[model samples]
Target: MSMPIESMLLAVSLNFLVFSVSFDDMIGQSFASLVPTMAAVESAIGLAIFVITFRVRGTIVVESINCIQG
Candidate 1:
């Protein structure tokens, strides 16, 4: 049996959300304030790439990949 991509992505995203909180806190304590600004810029660049990919394929991941079952 295979699971839907939506559920898998949701699980990963949830886990990452928790991890990111701790990771960001560590960065805040270890580095100067400007370090977090760089991470924010990178996140924005990633968001742009996601938007471009969605515009091109109408999906976040390749449709062909979703055709494959686990």
Candidate 2:
């Protein structure tokens, strides 16, 4: 439930931070100016990633917990 969503956010946040650093060099616009576009694209991509992962893994924490307790 929350795990996939949190994972998605973590991935997006790391990528956004990394992209922000080089954005100034690649694009002439300031980071603040590009925030809207960056946020939109990243949010869509992050949600897609979460959906795909959730579809494949399907709340994997329960399985891991079972394995650990066994």
Candidate 3:
């Protein structure tokens, strides 16, 4: 489950990074100058959400399996 999700995330992030870099250079500006600040903020928020959800879901899955086995 998480493998696919992680792979998708990796692909999406890589694509965005590549696109942003090219767009920035084409516009004659530093890649990070346009959106690095905002990107950092967004990345933190997304990471937090991912961590919380993953932890909660993982806990639920573990509990369910344990319950079934016991």
Candidate 4:
């Protein structure tokens, strides 16, 4: 049985969240001045995943042909 897309996405998001939180603390110890920079990096990665998900049709194919038509 296959998991729904929403479930998969939620799982991935949570995984990233955990990773980011851990990294945030580690980064905090070193360059405390770059918290904003770390946040922007996380945001950019999340946005990229969102875009790629929307681009997927049935199996993970990027709808390049549809993109050109639209």
Which predicted model would earn the best lDDT?
Answer: 2
The best-first sequence of candidates by TM-score reads 1, 3, 4, 2
| TM-score per model over all chains | 0.43, 0.36, 0.38, 0.37
Model 2 lDDT tens row, 10-65: 57665666776776453333433555565667678878866765676676455543
Candidate 1 vs candidate 4: the lDDT winner is 1
Residue 10 accuracy (lDDT) in model 4: 51
Tell me the TM-score of model 4.
Answer: 0.37
Off by over 4 Å in 3: 25-70
RMSD of 3: 8.1
Per-residue lDDT over 1-70 for candidate 1, one digit per residue giving the tens place of the 0 to 100 score: 1135435544655565566677765543333434446556766777896787677667786664466454
Off by over 4 Å in 1: 1-31, 62-70
The lDDT values for all models are 0.57, 0.59, 0.56, 0.54
Ranking of models by lDDT: 2, 1, 3, 4
> Which stretches of model 4 miss by more than 4 angstroms?
1-30, 58-70
Give the top-scoring candidate (TM-score).
Answer: 1
Backbone clashes in candidate 1 total 0
C-alpha-based local distance difference test score of model 1: 0.57
Q: Which residue pairs in model 3 clash with each other?
A: none
The weakest ten consecutive residues by lDDT in model 3 span 25-34
